[model samples]
Target chain A: MDPVGLSGYLTVGAVLFVCGVICMATKRNAVGVLMGVELVLNGANINFVAFSRHTALGLDGQIASLFVIVLAAAEAAVALAIVLNFYNNHLTIDVDRAVELKG
Target chain B: MSVPELLNHVLHTDLPRSVQIFAPELVLCVTIIALLLVRMLKWHHKFPTSWVALFGTLAAFVGVFAQFMYMKTGGELPQMRELFEFWGLTQAGVGTAGEYFTGLLVHDPFAVFFRLGLVLFLVLVQALTILTGIPDQEDGQDFYTLMIGATIGMMLACGANNLLMLFMAVEMMSVPSYAMVGFLKGRRLSSEAALKYVVYGAGIAGVMVYGVSLLAGVLGTLSIPELGSRFELLMGDQPFSLTNPTAVATALGIMLVVVGLAFKLSLVPFHFWCPDAFEGASAEVGGFLSVASKAAAFALLVRFALAFQGSGEAIQTLCLIFGISLGVVSCLSMTLGNLAAYTQTNLKRLLAYSTIAHAGYMVMAISALMVLLSGSADPVDSAACVEGLMYYIAVYLFMNLTAFAVVAFVRNETYREDIEAYNGLSAGGPMTKLLCFCLLIAFVSLVGLPPMGGFFGKFAIFASALKAGSVHWFLWVVLAIGGLNTVFSLFYYLKVLRAVFILPSADESRTVEIPGFNGAYVALITLPILALGMSWVMGDLTATAHDVAAYLFH
Candidate 1:
């Protein structure tokens, strides 16, 4: 069998990205939404790594993915802290419950 | 290059120059650390963190001011160059403009201009917080830390030259703001706002990065300037269409990235987070997000869009489409924001919607800019489009700041931010009257009436859009809609003013009494809006903006 090519890796990344967007759209749990965001970021990361290996992107793609990883982790930490704050106040983590400041 | 050779060049050459060019941000960094260290060492009792933050921001402002002067003077001033030499920062290192930090970012007149505005804004915000006392002594360190960190991120955003740097800058600017929106820890609304802000922010950021990956992979590069050149090569002279997979992917990437920026600017469709976050956050934080973040995002937007500008039929077609789409978004943002703002009872929510509308107006300038650049229009006219944007942002900083400052002070005295809370403000004491007058000027300017800065800003942008209509007839329609929106906006602003000046006080026994300091602060910032209306001041600012805008084209 032929080795899995760039298109195969791209197909996987696209699926992950589509799934993540769907997850974000459907999920009402704040943490679930955050996890969706993570999935999307990791999907992008996979694309970056695959492109670095397969294309003329050279080291830029790999370096960008690393930065994205660090940023995603930091974002998750801040998001979780914010979620904790919400839970403390409302006694739940459902985003639908955050309707206090609606128009 | 061997490791040692690369290290030698970087250590001796790149380090000094990059550090010098990056001095203002470095100063801000040290300030952030000092703010934390003061609390860590338990010195908060004797020394106030607000003072520390103010002085640090002032220092950075001076640094940016000097850098601006240096760039404008072309590093020819003997005294200024000598001053830099005194600090061991060479003329070649500080004032000279080009890519810095291995082309990850740039040091140019445009970036310096935005940095100057942002740092000065940081100083002003610090002073306002000192007066308003939003964060008590215990939370001062953490508050200023987040605020300065965000400012630094915004500064970087103005200078981002690479796709990676662009993403990093946006994230850096956003993360701290998320924490800040929820700074009032005990408030349920504040926490809720932060929750919504983070979830939306993270989701959009993910979509944006994914777009970045696609663009980078398809183009095989991440450098912004290279993206254009690579794109031109990829397409050759072929017409750009969906049938071409490369063009399709590239267009998708660009659209997704713009969506993320649109979210930051609170344009229509992606603007759901704005009103909630502003109403949840304190008025002071609202002021920061509305003014500083908008300025930085606009700067980044211009930079990103301009990266695709070049001469070719296909490229021109793409740019024309981009410009038209931007015009559509601008139209929607303005109309939606103004219409939504009409019914808002909460002052902060009203201002948030107003922010969205103002963003729409500013984006109109950019749309004109893109269209002008796409066509073979006069370079002078293209430069004028950017000039309008720069002038608008500068005027907006003062207009919005004054408005939010009034809200903060009133909230302090009355602990209420409803329109009803401001009823009969003009009937109060002298200080309250002055505060009310300042709000009138801010609101009037926001309505783009004459004899105020917003008029000139709106005039410049509308004029540019009219000029762009010569290139494409659609911009004329955009301009007309913009003018009508300006008229539409006047009623809501007057509605608030009527409440303040015409309506009777809710309680006959109670009168709002604004402190002298807060009243003076509002008046001081409001003076600029009035002063900028004068031809002399407007001429000077326009010239400066022209100079900065010219840098991008060159």
Candidate 2:
């Protein structure tokens, strides 16, 4: 079988992006929100790689995908570190508890 | 040349010049490494990390100065006449000539000038950190390291010439700031602020990257300068259509990208995290975010908006759409900011709202810029718009920093942040009164009163808005809103002053005697707020701003 078309890959990416955004909006767990962030980033990554393969966008797309992966990991590390601090202070990872600074 | 030959040529020919242009960044990177090493080796015990941070920042400032001097005088030490010619730092004879790092970054006058500003700002913030004792001796190295790391990111953001560079630069700047916001470890509010900041920041960044993917895929390029011509080809003379994937994708991508930038600028509808972060974090961190992050974001926004070069009809329409929408956002941000600030009792939260309002003011200049560009005539007015932005940022740095510094100082002495807590500040005697006076000056300057720096900044922006109003009638409305918001802002800023001098403290024990050095520090920072307002001295600032605007257009 031939490889999937650009539209197919884009459809998959769009689904993932939507799921990720919805997750970010709905999740109360800090780590769950982080997972949503990763999903959104990877969704974008899939689009970048697909473009590099199927379209005239050459190495730049692949390079961008690689960067997205690295930066996603970096973001996760930082988010988790913050989560650890939150857990330490409140003994919970529930973002709802982190509202001491509200108006 | 063949592909391999082209790659080889870029590697050999471009690499050396890129390093030369990146000298200041190199200094900052070296400083970060040195700071870490000093910490691991316990050198910070003998030599303070704050000193190391300050020394590194000063060195970077000197590096920028040397480059500027070299550009101006062709590497020769200046004689008296040449010195006179270059004095007041007009950026005379400095063209837009730049060294490019392949496609990553460009070292132009705009980049250099902002880098200079960031480094100078770092020097002062480092001093403030030392004086305020935000970073105790045990953690000084970590604090300075994060601070310097963030500065490097900001400098890079100012010079990013490619989409990849832009994303990386923004992340680089933001990551350290997240750490800095939570730097006061074991504090409940600090960690909460960092969590909120990271979640929101990471989510927006992902959205931005998705937008980037769509844009780059459709356009088949990530080089910003190349996007314009490609846009002209893909969008030229095309009527609006939902059926056109290219057009829809481009529009979607642009709006998504703007969302990311707006989050950083803390414009309304995307400004939810700003006040919470400010209220949770220390005043020092708040000041850093308000000034440095906002400046870098404005720089990125200008570069992104201006990247659509040339005079194609399709491009002109796109510019107009951007202008009108930006105007609406500006109006919303200022009105919301001023109204929300009215009932706030926390000083930091109030300033955060003030920052949002000021962002609205700055974005008005962008709208003016776009409106002027849509005309494709009167490039001078557009340059004035850019100059207005640069000038506003320059003055805003001092005005906002001084306000936050005063807050940090008083918080140190009294551990209070509420307006009601500051009752009868004038009754605390001369030192306390002097601090009160400085706060008054800062608040008045923030209100854009005469004889203060903010007046000139606001004046420059409002003047450009009026200039653009000649071409587009809507900008007159933007000008009207800007003027009205300035009046609205005055009530809240002065309420702090009134609390300080007018309202009497019911508890006499609340008044604390501030030390002489802290009062002197307050005066030191406050002096520039007055100096930049003087007519004769402001000539240099306008000249510098003009030079930067000219270079950007080039």
Best by DockQ, which number?
1
List CA RMSD, all candidates. Answer: 1.5, 3.1
Which window of 10 residues has the lowest lDDT sum in candidate 2 chain B?
B87-96
Model 1 lDDT vs. the true structure?
A: 0.91
Model 2: per-residue lDDT, tens digit, A1-99?
A: 246688899999999999999999999999999899888998899999999988768899999999989988888898899989988998998988887
| lDDT to native, each model | 0.91, 0.84
Candidate 2 segments exceeding 4 Å error: A1-3, B2-8, B72-96, B240-243
**Top lDDT hit:** 1
Model 2, B412-447: lDDT tens digits are 987988878788878886788898888888888889
Q: What is the DockQ score of candidate 1, to 2 decimals?
A: 0.90
True contacts kept of each: 0.88, 0.77
lDDT at B351, model 1 = 96
